[model samples]
Target chain A: MAEGSFQYITLAASLPHLGALFSNADLPMSRYRLEERLSMLEDEDRRRLDRIAHVTSWPGVDGCDTDAEVVARFEAASRSVQAHPDLAAVVRERLETRMLVAALRLRRDGAADPAPVAAWGRTAIARAIRTNWSEPTFGLGRARPWLRAARALCAAGDHIGLERAVLTEVYRQIDRAADDHQFDFEAVAFFVMRFQLIERWQRYDATRARGRLEALLQSTLAGAWTAGNATPTGAGMAGSLSQ
Target chain B: MTDLVLVLGWFGLFAPVALGAIGSSIGCARAGSAAIGAMLDTETGYGRFIGASLMPSSQVIYGIVIMFSLQRDPMTAEAAAGVFGVGVLAGVALLYVGIRQGEVLASAIVAAKAKPEIFGISLAPAAVLEGFAVFALVFALVLSGSIPG
Candidate 1:
């Protein structure tokens, strides 16, 4: 078989696996059609798309491909979804899960430099969270289960996992605040700063992460002026400190 | 007559500031409520609250400028009087703007309190309202300064 043809076949085969990874109670197979019309492209284009599948599925499987090459393929896939808005959500969800799983595996393998892949995972998770949260039709009340799974997945990793855990806790706090009808400007500010910190850490910008952490702490102090029912816990305090 | 006009102008200019200050106080209080909501429930976005808090000061600054302009040209009683009238009108308009802005800020606070995650996208419109008020104040200041004898 020709290299190009082989790549197409591999991508075809991997689609099912990708689809399976994203499958669960929340996202049923009906919601995500893995067998939909695959993009017909030139052999070179097919090869490029295949690289994304390869990187996300098995980054260690050597193809002498650079990170830029992988990122390009992923970006292209991202763009493709944009062009076909109907397919955007499912494709993004599948791709994010694949990247997250790959990053987890890399961390498990004790890769000397897993930062980049882990960062990608963190970004993908953040996007997923935002997307899920923004769906007005879905309603915020129904977000807890999916959020829990995503949070757990994030918590299972290393340093990145810890950051994700803190973020998840913050989101939980926000949820609790809403339920109790005690939403205050100061607490909201703290969460926004927390989100910024995680975002900085995801980009491997330690300086920004540290700065955001300090800002979050300062905001917490300033938040004392509001004085609501929710007690700032030691865990919450520690999480900000670690950031 | 010039002193009266000058006084009127100062009053007009400061009126907006007073209204803006009240608006800001309300906005800040609304934000506080949202923050409390966030603390009690899930996390709410505070950026909107902070933005609302910052918005009212623009009117206050406009009032200060108008007062200064009137004081600077007190000798030109006719010009000062004319400027003062315009300033008063602007201040009244600004007062209305401030009150409306405060209400919008309050609504945003409610939304933020309900869903903190949406904060990244929700603050855009409220900011736009605040921007309009700022523009009005700026225009008033410019107009106040350009009044001729």
Candidate 2:
């Protein structure tokens, strides 16, 4: 695309704002602390992030407190990006992987059947979307191998390893997508996503990484009572490269 | 007839200036945006940023030199044609190089902002574009000597 074209300009303008959206979700920091950190960014950067956040946030969804609600929030965000099919696919893939891992964790902890894990919402439907028959084998199948890795990590009680595996996988796809489509708008989006991912990953204190892993496992073990906790703090593998 | 030769000679004399100026303006402007964006991310290193942005400005200087070299007291039709051909082609070449070089500089600025240590390395591509512009300038200057005055 020409540099000054609408699509190119829009993609360029949207890139800096992604800093906030994809920032490592593995941290347990408070929203206020996140806001304080954001305040230090350039005015243009701050404004763009705020504007995108405002647009994407649902009207009545005040603080998603359950796995179902969190999934809903992700779905809403994914739909918001539907104007760009490649981005929508990338985002949807990320959400699906998270859902898969969370379900596997629930199954490992107590739940015998994974089908009704989120009866309050259409978790089954979301799963179906992720495992659709029409998609590429290696692309969608990549998540399955990661799912197996997550299960193995859970079996071994390797919380840190699980976090590292899942997050790295999520960004692996994004980074690959970016590299594969170097000249497209999706490449810019992928680069920005990867940037945000790295920012968040770096910000997490390496020394306290184990404690964070314990926190994640503890919340997972708490079952439905603690499922909502994962929503705020986020649950995933991060900083695998750091280790 | 004499007036036409003078007119053609004047056009040849100024062609590089017009084309090179357009290129420099566009290139510098493009690079300036990236430099300005990067300066916001760092407090120091403003000097390097400014220096990078001015990379395209050299095209205009080349244009000016070519304009002066093309000037002659008794300009002939053949000489005027030679002047117009060399000056205009060189100007056009410089114009393209300047704009492309600016884009390269802009990308370098973006990358350097992300990782400050890559500042020097990021300039490599822009230097190559500048080399192409230099090649055009040198050839124009050398060829001007052969044109009948």
Task: List ranges where model 2 is wrong by over 4 Å.
Answer: A1-89, A102-148, A154-157, A174-243, B1-13, B72-81, B110-118
Q: All models, DockQ values?
A: 0.01, 0.18
Name the regions of candidate 1 deviating beyond 4 angstroms.
A1-243, B1-3, B43-54
Candidate 1: tens digits of C-alpha lDDT, residues B39-147:
3333343454556545545556665665565454344655656655666676665566555554455455545544556655666676776677667667766776677
Worst 10 residues of 1 chain A by lDDT: A13-22
- TM-score versus the correct structure, for each prediction: 0.34, 0.60
Model 1, docking class: incorrect
Tens-digit per-residue lDDT, A107-186, candidate 1: 44554544455334345453443344333211322543443444345446455554444345444443343332212222
Please provide, for model 2 over A86-186, each residue's C-alpha lDDT reduced to its tens digit, 9 standing for 90 to 100: 66667766666666666556656776544544443554435453344223221344546666567678768888688777777877777655554532455
